[model samples]
Target: MGNILCDGSPIESDPRYRFQGRQWETSMMDAPCNNCKGCFLAMFCPCCFAYHLRVLALEGRMENYSCCQGYLCPTCTSKCIPGQDSCPEFCLCLEVTLCENFAISSTRFYIQDQRQIMTDPCDNRIIRFNNCVQILSFVCHILAIFFRELRHLAHLLDLFADLVYCMVQACMQAQTHHELTLHPTAVDYGQAPRTITQQPTASDKAPLMGHQAPPAYSE
Candidate 1:
């Protein structure tokens, strides 16, 4: 028995053996590559193109894929008049755009996090990555071969951390400490010195008006 077709007929007996049927023509794999404009449009905005393609596929209508038809619907509903089905399409487009924006923002944050992980030796990210790699190596021993090498690499990284610490310390020491510390004799224009006051001794006190002096006692 030769190859059998889906309709329970031999491939050779089928009239459309070589994809001559409409089914084959409509298939995604058989979609023509002649439309360079469509290709570029899809390439630039795959999400929009995919939504359009999905609509066309489900509706089985070629007219629905017209340029005027927005990504959400098979008609020009840009005005968004009430009682029209355009609201759903507009909401869908908005959702896709928002999701794409969020994905882009998340990717940027992930890239920044990765950069921080690679640059900052103090963080445990490197160690955690190394541990993850070693654990993965259990499933594939090719990584196990580099076990000693990774340890050496970790040591080198620690050395680099020490070097960075020393460099920071040297930089700090090289800076003028005079700028940070106050001079012992420097006058502060912002404030005035407080005057020192002391209580007068009894002998130093002058006699009050109308107050008689005490009689002196003999030693």
Candidate 2:
């Protein structure tokens, strides 16, 4: 008979281990209202917002976060790219500007992992809705290939779906920024050692008085 208990692997070695974490503090829809600044940045300039979130995830250590840190960098090197040292800010700027979605998603995942925050149900629903819309748009495109009348409608659907998807991404980024504010990392406290100076009072400045010698000893 094969020994079932003889395996030397650790219990956590299983790839199917369930992730345990707390739920998000606020839903994505509510996040924008909760943090107006974050929402404004996300909606107007998503690339900058994504880069800010990446930095926030690393506890404000901008140098630590690089372009495609975990995705492209299989080895997860500290440097932006292996061997050739590159500026983190430049690489991250390029990443967020060119690959905004990937940058935002990666930063979200990184923050979630570090803080052990579970994905909100609203996020799942939005993602599913986006996927369904994309599929429907693709189907519309396919049908338009045969029915020429649907070509304009298909193009419109594609454009609308893409716009919605972009909006959803922006909202999610705003939500992430809000969440970071709610649960700040230790480094956010600004706990660097500081020397405190106190003014000297008259009592403190008084010289130490020696005990008087006995009169008999003086004689």
Candidate 3:
């Protein structure tokens, strides 16, 4: 099947899809400095910021924004709940409120997939950091079995690492938002309806032949 926007409009002709793979215009570390407003919003009000980014991924159509990029309800369009026509918005809000990290990650993945943007070194670094934290946490758990004091330390380390991870994720979201602003998707939603006019064909313009022509009139 061809590429479609969140609003279910076909976007096979979108310019962004013309290039199969490309790197982000700005790195994650530089995003906060480049777009201070986005960074501030992301850091201070991540839930709202995540929702806004999701809408941006949908080409600025708030109505088209979905919770988890509609992966939770692949078959349901517009409304995920039975007999409820306007449940998507509520669902999205709830998702952002309760599952902020998942919501933000889904939006980021959606944007990247639509634009064919590849993960950069910064993304790999974040992944490595998370991996290292997990490994350390496991080691700490094993060490805590012998040393009771290490148990408290492990809890403290986990809490600190979680805070740092959240901060890093917020920055990543800001970076994605800034990059999206620089290179917006070309979805058809929220635009004026198009009107198509059919041009006259060659046969329609051809002169009438033989008997089909009108008889010559006398002066």
For model 1, residues 1-219, the per-residue Cα lDDT tens digits are: 111111222223211212211111111121223333444544466446434433433243333222223322224344543432434455445433554322221221222121111112112222223333333333233332445445445444444543433322222111111111221121322333232233222122111101011122222
Model with the higher TM-score, candidate 1 or 2: 2
> Which is the winner by lDDT between candidate 2 and candidate 3?
2
lDDT of each: 0.28, 0.59, 0.57
Clashes of each: 0, 0, 0
The C-alpha stretches of model 2 lying farther than 4 A from their native spots are: 1-21, 72-85, 142-147, 186-219
Error of 3 at 2 (Å): 41
The RMSD of every model to the true structure, in order and in angstroms, is 41.8, 27.0, 23.6
User: TM-scores of the models, in the given order?
Assistant: 0.21, 0.65, 0.62
C-alpha lDDT of candidate 3 relative to the true structure: 0.57
Candidate ranking (TM-score, best to worst): 2, 3, 1
Task: Give every collision pair in model 3.
Answer: none
lDDT of 3 by residue, 1-219 (tens): 112111222133322223333666666667778878887888888888887787778775655655566544445533544422355566767778877766776776666555555455445455345445555665676677677777777776666666655666666787788777876763422332232233222121111100011122222
| Best-first order by lDDT | 2, 3, 1
Per-residue lDDT for 105 in model 2? 68
> Which candidate achieves the best lDDT against the true structure?
2
TM-score, candidate 2, is 0.65
Kindly list the per-residue Cα lDDT of model 2 for residues 66-185, writing each as its tens digit: 555564443553443543234677777777887776677677666654554544545655655555666677778778777778778887888877776666777778788877887777
Q: Cα deviation in Å at residue 137, candidate 3?
A: 4.0
